[model samples]
Target: MKTDRRSVIIGSALAGVALFAGGTLSAIMDVADARADPSPEALAQAGPLGDVVLGSDQAPVTIVEYASLTCPHCAAFATETFPQLKEKYIDTGKVKFIFREMPFDDLALAAAMVARCVPKDKFIPMVEMLFEQQKQWANQNARQELFNIAKLSGMTQTQFDECLKNEEIAKGLIDTSQRATKEFGVDSTPTFFVNGKILKGNRPLADFEALIKEAAPT
Candidate 1:
């Protein structure tokens, strides 16, 4: 298949990043036990693309997550830990969850773009599908594979292609990532800011619970 402007968009976005061995999963598996001081003001700063948040706005605790689409650790958290977190915290209005894109490769950027193209209400479900079916699609034939996934959400082939070629969406994701790296020292996939306290890695749900409890108001 002939490449399209989507390729150019990916190339432009990943220009400086090392394309080492065709961008193997860059997610760090075992992140060190580390945390950063809370930056509530910085965490509250809105991105250009705007946030698709989950749970009540008045929730006591807030979680801001920056994850890559192609990261296995991120998939693990999304498919496994996130459900429990959503059930116990988000659904209960105890925590507000915010997901931000931090694409690690060209494929990841493409996936994030497609996810953003969907209606705002469908964003979480679209991301859930991407994570659950990651093994099937995150490959050399990423374009077709991602289109297949998008189709499941009623997205047409034209929409899929258009989403991939959308430079504004692409740039928004890249800018979000750059700001994350600059302001929060985010260097790995699945990095999170729980009430503005940075936590790295695909930690167990218990780890999240502990932080959320601490952040919860007395």
Candidate 2:
């Protein structure tokens, strides 16, 4: 929270990378270059399924997350803390969960595209697999490995290719990232909005549980 927003986000302890669909290609996008406020019209726009949301729409608390697939902290939360939160909160309709793509780079953007291409019902599961096996599909020889994971989500290679190359999908993801930066000052991965309160970085499950308990409608 001290450094320049762009520097803060781009300089997170990003410890890994991922491969894109069909392999043999990669790109690095600097988050700094993605700085801009959307126009009023653009502000009203949204991505596929308006980004993945779960739990009852009537849940008293809404938790919105901005995460980058290549981010280790993001992966840690997904692996260690998310399940407990999901079990105690989302699954019980105690909290409405929203997961938005805040891709840290082009490879991440590609992964995000694949997640979105999945069936809406399968989105969370697909993302869980991506984070769970991140090391497998986040390297130079990740084409086939990624395909295997995509297959688990019912995405064919043809669909995978089409998805990575889809301009609209790419733009939608970019817009989501840009809005996160512009509106929320999201400079790092695993940034959580707990009932509209910003919780940056990878906080423990207990900490989040407390926030949920405090925010839940009485």
**Top model by lDDT, which number?**
1
Q: On a 0 to 100 scale, what is the lDDT of residue 18 in model 2? A: 24
Against the hidden true structure, what lDDT does model 1 obtain? 0.76
Off by over 4 Å in 2: 1-49
Number of backbone collisions per candidate: 0, 2
lDDT of 1 by residue, 1-218 (tens): 11122121233343213232244323222222233654877787878899879999999898999888888999999989999999999999999999998776667777888899988878888999999999988865666788788887889987876676676887788777767765666767788889988788889998998888888745
Best model number under TM-score: 1
Off by over 4 Å in 1: 1-35
Which pairs in model 1 have colliding backbones? none
lDDT of each: 0.76, 0.70
Each candidate's TM vs. the true structure? 0.84, 0.79
